[model samples]
Target: MFDLEQYLDMFLDESKEHLENLNRNLLKLEEDHSIETVNEIFRIAHTLKGMSSTMGFEKIATLTHKMENVLDDIRAGKLKITTAIIDLLFEGLDILDEFVKNIEAEGKESDRSIDNIINNLCNLNDVETTDSEKDSSSQLQDDFQYVTSIAQKAKDQGINCYEINVKLEESCILKAARAFLVFKAVEQNGEIIYSNPSTEDIEDENFSDNFNIIALTKLKKEDFKEKILAISEIKDVTIKDFDKDSINLDQVKNLTVNTGNKIQQNNEQNIESKNDQSESKQRKGKTSKTVRVDIDRLDNLMNLVSELIIVKTRLEDIDTDLKGQNMNEAIEYLERITTSLHDAVTKVRMVPIERVFNRFPRMVRDLSKELNKEINLIMEGEETEVDRTVIDEIGDPLIHLLRNSIDHGIETPEVRKSLGKSEVGTTKLIAYPDGNNVVIEVCDDGSGLNIEKIKKKALEKNIITKEQAEIMDDKEAAKLIFAPGFSTADKISDISGRGVGLDVVKTKIEALGGTVEIESEKNKGSKFIIRLPLTLAIIQALLVTVEDEKYAIPLNNIKEITSISTDNIRIVEGKEIVLYRGKTLPLINLGNVLDVERKSENNSKEIIVVIVKKGDKDLGLIVDNLIGQQEIVIKSLGKYLSGLSFIAGATILGNGSVALIIDTNSLFQREWYS
Candidate 1:
């Protein structure tokens, strides 16, 4: 009577975890082929099989079971690990992954044919068993010999060895659950040495109504049968003494032969195992010491912090009015408490970037093989943490960057060799926390960005005016790749030539309040550096006024604040420009950009300019006045005000006024200056 829907989330989560483990370990196995890696993969497959079987995902369970067998054969040294074997295992892993994805998306596995993978695995397993050093007879003899040894040991320890046959009703549902319960019941009293049709087959429900287990216990045959039959849905129970004389080689061989037939029959019936609530509870007890808090709950907590901001603001106002030392002291204490609380909440929202990094190695492996290039992807600082919301988004952009590197940055083995470089190109994904931001760098050791080729491509695509291209430096030319529909590839391919990747990387990163920059040297290498804010919820902002309107600029993006005489500003190419530190800085009037009302003209001799940076470029924003800095909580302007240029979001001021937060990254766009 267990409801499968209730445990669907747990099932999907565990399935994803197991798939990640399999992918990581399989990649390791491909390189090392160590016994430990093989064992770990086998354990993962076994657990996935059981979980999928219990969840009634027949395709997933079937595929994982086949994977388990092959891994087992490899573990037993019956099969030698080879490139072909590893590739085949990866193929099976892919199919299982697809099945899990299908189940996750549609609440049931896709009808995609897994027969090819299953047959391939079976062929491999068959080759190991029938063509190994030990023949089929020897394998059976080994099994019996091991069983005989265990039985002899049991007898010497004054324990009775009995073969217990368990039969379920023909109409029984959830045979796996029933069998698991029966196993649990018997194991509570004794140890199970072996099971006909194999314990794996029974757990996967790849068996008929009856299965037999050999048990070493002090209980008599009648007592064991009585205990087993006491359970519901028990059609019958039979027990017999276990000894060497009872070991029938032909019978065991036939049982092994018929297991495939039973699986086929069961699959035909579309039999699904029902969820076992008790087993789910057992799993819950053994989980790691962490809770999966709903994201909505975290959002609620953040909202509460926003409310606390209002309280803190009101306290500051009271302190200002009372003009007393005691009031000031109370406000200071509250400030400290609120600061600590904010840090605690930010830490709670932070999660390791490892979750995004783990999937890349497998991707790199696949791409290297596809492009016929040799790439060694090195990842570092995977333990660096970012806000959970950022973690969810940052993965796709990283993928696009890595894929772009593999396809466009890294050279093929032959090309690399001819260039007098090592055949294997290195692509590194590095991440680290820097101040209030996280910096991720995707670097490659290959042919660097060809500035000339980029300029040529830009001209051909009309992405840059010839006049501008002629005057552009190598650094400026290299950035042309990020322009929409700009690519240097000679021919179009599935991987890159559509010229959609880097632009997406730019747009998405900027949307997340982050910035992307490229550093490249011709004939050397290229590195794409992305800087992202640690959290999007709250931040330190420099509040500025333009006319009567107020705006918040992220403090991290502000390089410096300075005053410039009106005479220093010059009109260049129809743009207001100022020379700062010998560099021509473009100036944008914040009041004009936001269309704020100018109540009166400013007659001041000096203009207050806020210099903000995006990547290597800087722009000066002219504001009416600076209101110092404040810790502000960013609230979304919601869908109605979404896609508003220049305004990233809105924040509440201490005086209960709403100030728009500036999207500094957007200010660097060419359209903004134009």
Candidate 2:
């Protein structure tokens, strides 16, 4: 028997991708009402319906069929697209997305109330309720004529025609697998001539607790029943010999006409067959070829490459000691190969940020309707690639950020008109590569951040001291929005003003070794700039020793390395500071901050300072030694060391010792508290 569970993961992945395409195409159809877009949607809907039916998901199959009818009518010029239809289609897509999620979690689509939507779809498209719902008798009627003819021919050849009805237990978990076993059992004793819901539908689990099959077999009826009963989870099985004499051709033709199965209609079949062939070719031409790989497999491959690099690094250390030319050359070759392999693995783990961006258009549309505002969302550089790990964690934070923009940043139409700006507010999400990082900027052309209001809220919430609030500049006050429980809204709604979102965004971003900053103009707008590393698995880092222990600082955060005399360091109000290139930079002693015991303090004549940039500002990190830069793979410190302050992760060095990766941004956070 075929194991349907083995293919469940593949089905869920493909269905999600197809559902995403449907949403994208439907959004396009709503915007342009183009024939080409409608055709693409029809093709996708048809494929989805076929897949769902084969998988035995009746709800998904029925709903997509209804949607297919409407698309069919629209493409045929029998109906026109309207706001109601667009809303209905979007509603269907949302339910479908939810259904897929449920399937992923529970291995079956959870029961959801879809009758109202299905009814609306049927009423809009002029399809009978029963026809769209796939009543078993009506569904069986579509194949009655064909089955009768085949059964008559079998009867003439001295073959017994049997109708097998299988009722599985209600608690059966793997219904599809069980149904496949039934088919296997039937085919072993006889040939399956026809089935009520079709073999594809049975395999897909489109039916409820029971399915029917008609077979021509030479075995005794008792023997066939015993074969099916041996399978597990079967509630009961009923076998009856089908009598061809009782099947009236006229009645079969009438039932066929009543059932609106397009394939049964004589002239429509030819036309539909031609259309199917044409669409098959079109789909073949337009389909984007891709495959899904298991993430665990990729992670295993990355670990292997990391091990190879560690071995190479060990060999390099030996080469320096032994001074063998041949060994040095071999090590050089190994280095080149490992570098290429690292690049290849990183590329494989890269995915376009568009995957996260695609869902926002639909969200913005719904929010605009709910808030009674006109807002246009513009996106740019959506094709920028980021590490898969980053892509997965960044989505919720970005969603919270966007929701904050719509709720707090954008003003209403009347307010915008009064302010001499366009009535429609604009929110733009743009991403691009900068140095070794990816920068995402979310900006809104609406009422900008109110610095005084934010400061007041910050003070009221006890997030900032009154003295600090009084001395803060506009930029400093705006940053207070990220402080815990800081919201300027007078009232809380479902959308925002809960005082919970931005803090989570800040924490999550910082956890990923990224930083976020806010810039605002009084009447113009506000922009939230988020900077994230390109990849998290492996990085170019500058290794430094604090006291006796070593740490790795990501090279992307370092601006420059400078040597300053101990006399050059200035003490201002008991805080260590240094003036570098016309800017006063605060200095943080790595040894003291991480609680490492120092051999001595400020005893050396020369001090090594590593300048790290956070946004437009710089901080000098005082270190004892500057180890050379190297490419290292980051490894999580696991749960025991998870909450270690200012430490991002740990990596293995050539000496087989673990060096904790420092999160430079967290150092700034520590100083803010101090």
Candidate 3:
């Protein structure tokens, strides 16, 4: 028996891709009423209909079929594209999306009522609803005519057309698989142009034990029957010649009269098919290739690369004299190979950020209407790529930022015009690769962050003291918006204003080994910049020692390294601080924070400090000694030890010892610094 479970993942993946295409193209259609866009949408709808039907998702199939009819009418110029029509189509797309989500979550479509959207679509196209049996019977005459046309074409090409009937045994378990096998067998002899219950119905096992096929082949009747009966489950096979002359002349005339446009469409399709064949032949040697491997498999491949790096490190630590010059050369070569392998695996795990950016245009459009504001959203650098793991976690943070921009940053049309700005406020989302990081900036040309308002809210929420707010500069005031439980809005709504948005964005981004910063002016605009590492698995880190405990600090976060004398360190507000490069820098002692036991008191006068920058703030971490830098693989501290104060993860050292990596962002939190 065939295992349906094996195909579920593939089906869901493809269905989601199709849905995304439909949504993207529909948005395009709304803006530009071009025939190409309409036809593309029609094609997508038809394909989704067939796929859902074959998968036995009757609601999706039925709904898409209705959508297809409306698109067909629009293509035929029977109905004009309008806002109402577009909205109705969008409503239908939403339903289809929900259905797909339900299938993915529950292994079946949702039981929600689709009658409203279905009826709305029917009313739009003036299509009458009918029972399945009635619908199938009504299409029999059209199906017969279609088969006759194919048969006539085959006869002209000097090929014989035959109607073949095959019946399966009553005990047939996987009817769909058996039918597919039969089709494959028949295709080897000739082409099966038509089927009795339609190919989709047969694949869905919606038919009885018996089914018919119209085949165009050069083989004789007995030979075709013999080939089909060779299958294991076949109970009987019958074959008969299909004669076009047997079709009634009156019926042909009526079909031509009623479906003249459809016939023209069929002719156009034939030309397209011939063109496609020519193109296929011209490009036969080259094939586009892609494969969808489960994420777990990619993670395993990354683990292997990490192990190879560890082995390389081990070889490098070996005594060179005992192993000789050959060992040195071998180690060098292994290091080069491991580096290249690591890069290759990392590339494999990287995906274009466009997957996360595609959904925002629709979101911005809906929000524009909801807020009764004329807003234009511009996006760039969609081709920037990040690790697959980052891609999966980055969407929500970006959404929060975008929503925050729309609700709190961009002003209304009248307000914008009064401020001498464009009536239609503009919001821009731009992404680009910067060195080892991908930087995403969300900017708006509307009213910027209200510094005073933010400070007021911070004080009201007890997020900051009045003394701190009074001394805060404009930049520091803007940063206050990211404080937990901070909001400047007078009332809360669905968009934001529950004091839960920016903090979440900040937390999530920092958790992904990224950083978020804000730049804003009172009447100008606001730009939120987010910087994320390309990959999380392996990174170059500066190894350090606090007392006897070893730790790793990500190289990307390090701005500079310097030493300060004990006399230069000062205390302010009961926290240690130092003047560096004419600016005050807060200092955190790593040994004290981690509670590492001191081996002995040091008589050293200088202290080694690693300066790490989070956003616009800088802090110095006091460490015992620097072990230089090394490429390290980050391994998660298991669930039991997760959320360990400032430890991000652990890495295996060359000596097989483990060193915990510092979470620099966490150390920069207000509690640690302020």
Best by TM-score: 1
lDDT of 2: 0.81
Using all chains and alpha carbons, the TM-scores for the candidates as numbered come to 0.86, 0.76, 0.83
The alpha-carbon deviation from the true structure for residue 188 of candidate 2, after best TM-score superposition, in angstroms, is 31
User: Local error of candidate 1 at 497, Å?
Assistant: 5.5
Residues forming the 10-long window of minimal summed lDDT in candidate 3: 251-260
lDDT of 1 by residue, 344-367 (tens): 998999999999999999999999
- TM-score-based ranking, best first? 1, 3, 2
Better of 2 and 3 by lDDT: 3
lDDT of 2 at 332: 90
Clashing pairs in model 2? 54-204, 55-204, 56-204, 56-205, 56-206
List, residue by residue over 1-674, the lDDT tens digit for candidate 3: 65677788888898888888888998999899877788888879988887887778899999998898788667645578889888888888889999999999999999998888888888766643233235554555565666677668667766778877899999998888788889888876666665666565675588899887777677788888888888889999988888656445343322211122433343334322557546755676454457788999999999999999988887877776678888888988999999999999999999999999988988898888899988888999999999999999999988988888887788888888888888898889999999999999999986788777788888888888999988989988878778776788788788975235778888899999999888887778889899999999999999999877899999999999999998998988889999999999999888988889888876689999999998778999999999989999999999999978989999998889999999998887646596
Off by over 4 Å in 3: 127-288, 320-323, 497-500, 670-672
lDDT computed for candidate 3 = 0.82
- Displacement of residue 189 (Cα, Å) in model 2 is 35
Select the stronger candidate by TM-score from 1 and 2. 1
Q: What is the lDDT of residue 52 in candidate 2?
A: 79
Better of 1 and 2 by lDDT: 1
